[model samples]
Target: MSKKQEPGAAGRATIRDVASAAKTGKTSVSRYLNGEKHLLSDDLKERIGRAISLLDYQPSQMARSLKSGQTRLVGLILADITNPYSVEVMRGVEAACRQEGLTLLVCNTNNELDQEKHYLQLLSSYRVDGIVVNAVGMREAAISTLQQANLPMVLIDRKVADFACDVIALNNVEATQMMTDHLLQNGFEALLFVTEPATVNTRLDRLRTFLQRMQQSPQCIAEQGEIELSNSQGLETLLRDFVARHPDKHKAVMCVNGALTLQVARAMRRLDMTWGPDIGLSGFDELVWADLAGVGITTFKQPTYDMGVAAIGQLVMRIQGNTEPVKDIEFSGELIARASTAAR
Candidate 1:
């Protein structure tokens, strides 16, 4: 009778365990595991295959990765997974990874600086082949550590202040220009660019570009208002104040992002302001609730998912040793017109 070996006390099967169960040496079992079964006799191959099924063996990815010098794993760090924009981008990144036969490990930092730093270090320790970042930015110490790891990285939407890695973001200047023009063309002479604060790169870019674009029309009123990201305490007062100050200027509010858009919309609802008739509204990013709002909201739809896929594409090139200069890629936005921005 042939001897059948059981797994050790660790509750796991090792190559040696499979070998013993197959009535063969570890070398034959290893050869079978590494796709060298043709070197062994048909009887040996059958025995090894039977033993593997009975043992329910799974190889250690870490061990194989150490031997091959490539993990075939990618890391994606997101600032806030709950954001609609982040969710769309994640789907794109994940889909591209699957097509490339690579596994993705996602880390959401919840817009926390310390958490972002922690994930940056954690992903590096995992020996991920590449990383995709979509956070406020990176710290100097964390940046140096990643550089030392020699890991390829790509940024989505947000630029690290000092590090010039490959970037996949929207063309803020052009997109802002487009939105401003659309509002002007629709007869909204008083435009107030609304945002959380001009702190992050994306917000600053849009706010600056909107100011510059609005300057061309010397007679029109161009201004900006800031609101706290998480607070809605005085938002209604802010929106109504903008409209009240410009009672005769055909006023409107152009939010710089989706979150701001939602906030402004809710504020409008609270003030009993019918967007199209009372105050014109135009902004960036698509929202599902926009269509159901009083006279659907007009928004500039960003190609967020495509940007996500492009981020991974750039990272893969670096992983393959492109060795070229860092890349800065931007995508244009599509204007999704609705009743909210109609001529009044």
Candidate 2:
């Protein structure tokens, strides 16, 4: 079936067309269109108005924004839009945008350095009032663009290491500390922290805090490891070896994010390992399946939606010309205790 074309997809009216129709120069048409009619005589206004009506001309918002310096658009660059954390953040950002009467434009980087640089440039080109960046890295190209970009940017959940900006993130130190203490209190003495590369601040903080807490627990056995989300076999092997090495010990695995949580859970299943009895499982982002999996996975539930709303609040204020010192806002998370971390 042939698809119908959108309105004005072909041969749409332009200011020049209106000007030609009205027997006036483009400046006169534009001035009239932009409500600078005082600069034009009554005859010019009438001719422009009649020509606009006859040609059904609609002015482009992009063109108007270029001249006015306000697009009423907020740009958002996300790491992975499909991540549960990102999805919640988006909901909050979208709701806040609606309340503030601004539109949202989003680009996903999928945690790729190249894509991050590309999307950063693309969003900057849009002339957004401000940006909410959940950035992956601050490599030279991205940092150069960020340094030169004048619009305000609010970072979410992760920091671009050296750049100073308002940051809205989970209290990683507090959350990870509390969760680690809980695991220790429950007697999960052998603990392994599984994550993707600790490249971003969130992972780095969590890994650091977990290691710190474990160090303080005199009897606790602690280890750190990384998993490639694409390498299920490697994850399974890592889990199997973790159990084999810590034989007869009460063991727990802490995943850094929801996507990794699911990956770890699946890898365990493939190895005929159930979380609660075979090993304790704890993670960061709370996903629905966390409670539905074999004996439910324990998670430190981040206030992702609230973080999103807060990011927009910060961005909107900056767009409104607030030049206060760069603020760091950290939201706290609650641990959802499930049987996944029950005494093993």
Candidate 3:
């Protein structure tokens, strides 16, 4: 007699539970569940049916779609889920997926190239209809492999080296230039651009743009530095040193992103430095806490939600067999001036 495993928590019954109840291997259960009952004996079919009834097991749409050859699932890979930028983009992606009646599977790589590769493989195994990726931008080989596999993919904010795809991102050059021009228009004589490692394409673009713009405008002295979030003391030391070097001049810090902006704000607080009059501050992102940071940190607000929606929309077009040329879609970031960059 086959053991009957009962379903728990209503929809909590897994394929493993069904197989166990039917006293069969997972492969056999999968074959039957995918509507290949003709391949199985009547006895096996009756047993599987009885098991499903007893357990009240319902197969997932993805499982059912395996037989239909279209899972209607999209994979979204984020470099770091903790970043507010990623969260905002995800909200838009989720909304678009819901409207399209598709499911989304999200993977957070924590900005690791290896993790990005791993998630790429994982998503591929699930036979996702398409993929939206905000990558760490180092996994060129993996990205190329996926591209070669003919999977529909959209790059968000970050572009992989040598792997051409539809990229939906901010206009890094224009936005960074705008921020730099705004800072120069103010009375700040010196600028310190602080950022994470310029590893990703977007970061690289912004850094390069800032440098180019500053070079064109000799009115301000500009310097770029990289910082890691893991070391607060190092950031503080860097901030202290930069401030100490510009004692007589009015200087401001230009953070690369919201994470760096938070770190700089904290470092300023630790050093008892005030924004405006003495020092000015501005960054790339306008986070939820941006206004709360001292006299409010100045920022360039990226259209993250729209970018997300655009990425998914492009991916869907690709999934539907659109063979048009891949073109990058860029959005502009708005500069929001605040007391952080106010003149003395």
Candidate 4:
């Protein structure tokens, strides 16, 4: 049986059609589409432009990119774009790509390994020049397969275990230590570290550093709590239990990131607890809403946009043939103090 014509393909204008209309060869049309107009005379350029306009011809970027061996396209996969950190990072990547005259294919994994794997395969099929991922770290096997393809890749904010690649993230250890020290200096004897789960690299690093710092202090008591993000009631319950457990000491709740900080702050408000004398709160992420929270939340401000730009830079360097040793770039976080962590 004869196949039916696809909806748009029947009237689509091909390079041959454009060349015929322009009274030129297909090679010349292809060159024009690939931004080699300078190689052709002004008269030929005008002819091609007129033909393209007349025919409503849309050149296949993928086909031209394949022939040229550079798509000028980059894939970006984020764990969750709804997070402010992810949004800031994406802005940086987008700005850098615009400056470089490149296009970005952005995907949100939502921390689902299966979705991430699927997007990786899809992006690979598109033949992107490189990929920058703020991974959920659950699909290392699929990522391993991509690594074998030798596509230039950069891991942003999170890294896969044992999968060596270029990584750009905040200095988690130093940032956690700084927050820990701030709480201790503010006369918080008991510190409770709150997080969603220690599933990703950044979370694990911050949690481990917090634990280690608390242990080293000897004078300050340390406790850790994990909140199931899907359950809001559970978070409030967890905070209430934490406060009950540390009734004797001046306690501070240290959130793992901005999201957790907001969660914890809300829970505290719901429980009729205040930030100043009753309980102090501080965490990573210098979110905009942090200051508006009760007595202004103390926070660690990460260079999110810069980190995103830096991640793309590393990926571009690899795409441009940088084959040196794998490097992990860590940007430092600045601690912003406010009434939240004020000494009693």
Candidate 5:
């Protein structure tokens, strides 16, 4: 009989023990277990399989990940988590990750490029499979670093001018054009475009589209044509002055996003300007209190949840080695006509 095996002395079986038991080299066992079967002979493969079964060997996931260089984890970097758009997008991303058996780690950059870069480097160091960025701007060096590491990434709700990556964003130009056309057809001659700043692509696109639409129409492109206001006081003063001067002309205002829309609404109320009778209002990114503000502000509703889900899907595909070329996906905004822009 063979020597009796000790009970407690038998430790966990490693790749070396498995190879020795199968009368093969450690490299063959490593290759076979890692699914690199082309390097092993059929006889050796059978022996390794038998040895693995007899020893009840289990591979260490940590060691396997170190060798394969894959974390099966995803990182999501949002510009601002407080924004409803970001929150909705995150919901979709989480859902997609759950379906794909991947983990999601979210970081809020608060719309800061430096913070975004820091998170990007941190995530890369942690060996995340990919990242989804929804920040305001992009830095070339930050993007190049990820590329150099062969890490997959996708942009959500924003786009970089030169960086070639998958992007999921809104159709800002079309939405703004549609909003402008609606206001024009409804007989609102004096229109104001209120926004935060024309820095990001979304803001710039909407402003350009609105200006272009106004330029084409001789009646709307007068000397006092489109009033572009940046701050709350400036916007309020401009609107108050416009109303005071052009009481005969139907006054209508368009806001770029939800935050600007809130400011516009407050200005209207503070200046004692009625919505339905005194002025007409419409804005983008329909907020929760949009309808509850007494005056129904007609606005464009973005598909926030769907955007998040699509961003995650694209990143997941990239992580899976589906690198054909960069793709840009745009989601259309829905036009909600309300009492604010009601025809009198």
Candidate 6:
């Protein structure tokens, strides 16, 4: 007894059926369907077109994509989407994705390694074409997982030196150096570099650059002052120490990012330190309060939007079979000098 055929089985035209109807090889039909139009002659193109129209064939995008091993979707894993940097980068990524006709999936890890790893695993399971990770610390396991899966990944605002992937970063070192130099040139001698932790690449690079630049001047070298804090409690402790230790010296502190800046502002209020005259300050990234904070903070303005745009562009390129080795793109951070760092 012969089994009955399914309703669409015989009616649906595969590449083989199209090729047979067009009097051409299956390879030619496959290539043409995949957008390799250059391989087909005018006559062959017409025959294939006629065959497809006659069969009323509708290609299964999912099946074709699976066969080609791609989904045309890019995933972005951010440390914290609340950060202005992350928000700006996301904007750029969305714009680029829209232009390329690709989809974007964003995941916020809140700076947790385990959460980041979980999101990475989820994105991989979804079979996304590529990923843009703005992660903290270097997790060899995470990098290895993505590499083993053959996913094209890019790092944004953070770098894992050992990981082989494109990086979209701000010129953290250069920007810090420039900000420190400006502080020095403006005659604010007592300098302190305050940051969250040295684990992330951006923080480490900024701290290193600030230290290196300050070392060039004998005054800063002699002081040897640096403050590293993890949370708001640590920030409070550091600020109290600063107030107690530098009662006489005019204080000029540099914060790594906006979160740090907010903490510093709160710390200043608690310590009763005046902004412009008594305590001079500058921050790495600008915040919503940078302008309105009791004392406006001078800050290094990163092109967060541009970084996002470039990251998406890179992911799209990788998806398009650009097998070129990974690259690191760095954008300059602008120094927006404000009242906080005004000279005495």
lDDT of 6: 0.80
Clash counts for all predictions: 0, 0, 0, 0, 0, 0
Q: Worst lDDT window (10 residues) for model 6?
A: 1-10
Per-residue lDDT of candidate 4, residues 127-197 (tens digit): 88999999877456776658756689999999888887899999999999999999888789988888887
Summing lDDT over every window of 10 consecutive residues in candidate 2, give the lowest-scoring window: 1-10
lDDT of 2 by residue, 66-101 (tens): 898899899888999989899999999999999998
Per-residue lDDT tens digits for candidate 5, residues 196-222, read: 656677887888888888988878632
Could you give candidate 1's per-residue lDDT for residues 54-150 as a string of tens digits? 8888878887788779898999999889889999999999999998879999999998888888888898898899999997557777677778877
| Residue 24 in model 3: lDDT | 86
- Cα lDDT over the full model 5: 0.81
**In model 1, which runs have C-alpha deviations exceeding 4 angstroms?**
1-11, 16-54
Candidates by TM-score, descending order: 1, 4, 2, 3, 6, 5
Model 1: lDDT equals 0.88
lDDT of 6 by residue, 1-344 (tens): 02222224676767777777789998898888889979899999988888877776677778877898777778989888988878888999998889887889999988888888788889999999999889865387776677767888788988886777899999887898889888888887678788775777788888888877877887752132344434656667776776678677767888888877777888788777867878788888877668887658898899988888888888778877899978889999799998888877
By TM-score, how accurate is candidate 3? 0.81
Compute the lDDT of residue 243 as modeled in candidate 1.
82
Task: Report lDDT per candidate.
Answer: 0.88, 0.88, 0.86, 0.87, 0.81, 0.80
Q: Which parts of model 6 have CA positions greater than 4 angstroms off?
A: 1-61, 221-230
Encode model 3's per-residue lDDT on 209-264: one tens digit a residue: 98999898686788888989778999999888888888888899999999988888
Query: Each prediction's TM-score against the native?
Result: 0.88, 0.83, 0.81, 0.86, 0.78, 0.80
1 or 5, which is superior by lDDT?
1
Clashing pairs in 4: none
lDDT of 4 at 224: 88
